[model samples]
Target: MIIKVENLTKVFKSYQRGNTFGEAVKSLFVRKPIYVHALKGISFNIEEGELVGFLGPNGAGKSTTLKILTGIMHPSGGKAEIMGYTPWKDRKKYVAKIGAVFGQKSQLLWDIPPVDAFYLNKAIYSIPERSFKKTLHKMVELLGVEELIKKPTRQLSLGERMKCEFIMAMLHKPKIVFLDEPTIGLDVIAKDKIREFILEMNRNGVTFILTTHDLDDIAHLAQRVIVVNHGEIVFDDSLTTLRNYLGVKKIISVSTMRPLPELRLPGIKITNRISDYKAELELDLSKYELNKFIALVNKSSTIMDLSVQDPEIEEVIKGLYH
Candidate 1:
């Protein structure tokens, strides 16, 4: 395993305000700090060159776990190792071999163009001149941001800045990269571009751990998903396994050539009726075969158009939380 975590946990101390003014005034002189268990001993492993999605609802220990793994914060307890290094204990040396990008944060100089920042990173990481040029050239081409790199950071759009952020993070060629909400505010085109770059990079053997609330990102980029809730790991498996485990279902919409009568079948739900000739039905595959159900429907009506769709990825993730 390139990354291994055993019983990792993190705790934080915070203070709660008094409910009433009188109590608040009295408590000021005798403030009591409350402890929050941000991470409750979560553990998982990732092999080299694997792309994994880290998912959770808000305040579910997702960010806490990432912070601990990246050495930005220390855990209250447990062990974590990435590439044979203890993140917090060997901070400087460990960071040299890893890269991270938080959607709300930036590593580039706000006043300078991204190319200048890249050079600064090259110097900081001690990257050779030849290696730096080769890597930068590839990244620039992959992202198609040659012009944007020359623009000042403050002037670039959100999507443009994000693309540059990826360049800065990968300039050093870190073994593992941690991305938090990398596509948070991007449009369809921008999101597709970023997703493509991620796929390309993964194919070239850079391991990635992505944390995002965007289910589409998981559907498009991650083969494996680890779901966290209330400071614990709730689900960890391949996307296919998750769909199967959740008892895969599909929504089928049909348009008939003639007026159709109300049809009823076991495990089939009539969701909507656009007209006498058009209707939508939900089919539970675990209860019955889709083809069997469709054939039965076809016998009764002349099917003009039909479409089948798997449950949305958002629905699947929401099911995990429930």
Candidate 2:
């Protein structure tokens, strides 16, 4: 395994004070402490060269786990081993074998050109000149950001800046990479380009752990997914398994010559009613027969058109969140 985490846990201490002025003033002298359990003994293993998606709603311990694994913050309990090294204990040596890119955080100085920041990373990592230049050129070329590197950071667009951010994190070509929302806000074209770049790099044997709210990213890049909620890992399986998490559920859109009947039936939910004659429903095959429902709908409304599709992936994820 490239990464193994056993019973990982984190707790944060914070002060709580009442809203009243008296309580606020009293809180300063006699503070009430609240312990927040951000992680509750989550465990998982990741093999080398596997692209996994680490996902969760906000405040669901996703960030906390990432911090511990990256060695920036110490966990309250449990153990994690990445490539046979304890992240928090092996500090300097561990970091050299891994890279991270936080979408909200910038590694490059705002006023300086990205190339200058690249040089700074080169010095910090002590990479050989020839290898540094070769890697930089390859990434820049793959991302089509050759000329953008010379422009000031502030001058680059969000997409442009993100491309440079990837280069900054990969200068040393670490074995593993941690990406947090790498495509937060971007046009469709830019998102596609970024996805392609990540796939190409993964093809070269770079393991990626991506945490993003974008389901598109998860669907396109991840072979495996790990979902956390309420400070615990609720689901960890292949993307296919996640899609089938709720069992056999399908979406059905129907248009008929007459108004539809009240879908007051088991295993069927009216998801959308565009009009009296046009409606969309979700059918759970496990509870109700598809042929029977079709016959009923056809008899009542004289079906003009009907289409069936798999439920959106979001439906599966939302089910897990609840």
Candidate 3:
């Protein structure tokens, strides 16, 4: 097994609804410890070389779970093993076999060239000189960060720095990689670069456990998605399964030659109506008869243009939480 987590739990002491002054006072005296069950007995097994997306909203224990897996934090209960090593035990040795890139945090020296940080990691990880050169060359070429690597991290743009970050993470060619919001602030091209790099690495037999707020990232890359909510695993399945469970609700926009009245149509939500010339409709695919809906709209006026799309993955996730 590449990763085996059984009944894993991480509890953090935090304050929840500290209401009364007397209650606060008592909390100070008795120290009312609120247990944040970050991972409530989460159990899953990731096979070798699989790329999986770990998804959750803010404070949903996604980061907490990753910290435990990477040996950055200790689990409060249960067990976790990555590549036959208990993540929290012998952390140094375990981590040497894994690479991590956390979007919110920077591991490179701000004022120095990115190559400096890359070399530092090379020395720290004790990579062989030949292997180091080979991997670094491949990463720089693949990520297209060769030009950016020579510049100080602080001088580079967000996207440029992100590319360097990715190269640094993979320089040692570790077997497993943990990426947290790898494309968080990147532009379209930068995001594409990171996505391509990830796919390339996975193709070369490296396992990846990714955490991100970008649903597009999950939709495009991950075949299997593990969704956590309120510190619990709410869903773990393929994107198709999740979409099927959510049902396919398509948004259709119709443009007419002239304006029309607000017509009450069955199984069609008139999300917006701008004069009689333009209207937007949110249609529930399961409920709406596709041809019937189309016919109804066609009868209204001469159709200028129309386009349809299912509700986005982000909308589906938000609905689940709500």
Best by lDDT, which number? Answer: 2
- Go through the candidates in order and give each one's C-alpha lDDT: 0.91, 0.94, 0.86
Clashes by residue pair, model 2: none
lDDT of 2: 0.94
Clashing pairs in 3: 259-276, 260-276
Candidate 3 C-alpha lDDT tens digits along 1-322: 8899999988888765458988777777576558777778899999998999998889999999999999999989999888999989979899999999999899889999999999999999998999999988988998887788998889999988888888888888889999999899889988988898899889999999999999989987897999899878888988887776677788888888766546676667888886668888788777887777777667867678889877778877876676
Residue 95 lDDT (model 2):
99
Tell me which of candidates 1 and 2 scores higher on lDDT: 2
Q: Which stretches of candidate 2 lie over 4 Å from their true place?
A: 258-263, 289-304
Worst 10 residues of 2 by lDDT: 307-316
Model 2, span 112-195: residue lDDT tens? 999999999999999999999999999999999989999999999999999999999999999999999999987888899999
Highest TM-score scorer? 1
Candidate 2 clashes: the total is: 0
TM-score of each: 0.95, 0.94, 0.91
* Prediction 3 TM-score vs. true: 0.91
